[model samples]
Target: MIGARVRQFRTARGLTMSELADRAGVAKSYLSAIERDLQTNPSIQFIEKIANVLDVDINALLKDEAATNSSDETAALDEEWQKLIAEAMESGVSKEEFKDFLEYNKWKLKQK
Candidate 1:
């Protein structure tokens, strides 16, 4: 289950197993074992490393597939939104700054 999620995020990010293993600093054999479900109980530190390399939250890698799929479907971003977010990230706009902008806009709307 966790392995599948790791593979899903990894592939979605266009990273091969070897790339992921190399970036995460884990052995390729060990990563392969995890993805194959041959190693079911990876340590928290290992998971953290993989999640960091994958650019995903740890829970995204740990959640059950069914639950994750349902939530992801409901939370899916449109392409424009995705592009905007990517642009914002590339421009170095911190999440806190974005949140502050949103709050300011909300307050402005209330005033109007």
Candidate 2:
């Protein structure tokens, strides 16, 4: 999951693996391994290097879904949707309101 999150954030930032590896000062092969889940455990220093280049906190890189709040759940969104979600967050749209909107949309679709 950490591997997936790293890849997601890296891709969302429009970075290629080579680019990220170079920027993070880690080996491209190692980064690729991490992304592919071939390497399940990485050192803290390694994570810090990648996270710094990715512009996310170390905690964000390590957090499990159950530990996540509503905003943290947006990390998996595609780039366009991420932008929309960010905009909504910045506009102060509460999580409860978003949940209500989603439920309403589902109901509306069913009615149709």
Q: What is the C-alpha lDDT of each candidate?
A: 0.80, 0.82
Residue pairs that clash (backbone atoms under 3 angstroms), model 2: none
**Model 1: which residue pairs collide?**
none
lDDT of 2 by residue, 12-106 (tens): 66679999999999999999999899998999999999999877899877876533547644634545665566567658998899999999999
Model 2: ten consecutive residues of lowest lDDT: 66-75
Residue 67's lDDT in candidate 1: 61
Q: For candidate 1, write residues 1-112 as lDDT tens digits.
A: 8887787667666678999999999999999999999998999999999999877789877886456455555444432454566467658999999999999999999999
Candidate 2 Cα deviation (angstroms), residue 40: 0.6
Clashes of each: 0, 0
| TM-score, per-candidate, Cα-based | 0.62, 0.62
Off by over 4 Å in 2: 66-112
- Tell me the TM-score of model 1: 0.62
lDDT of 1: 0.80
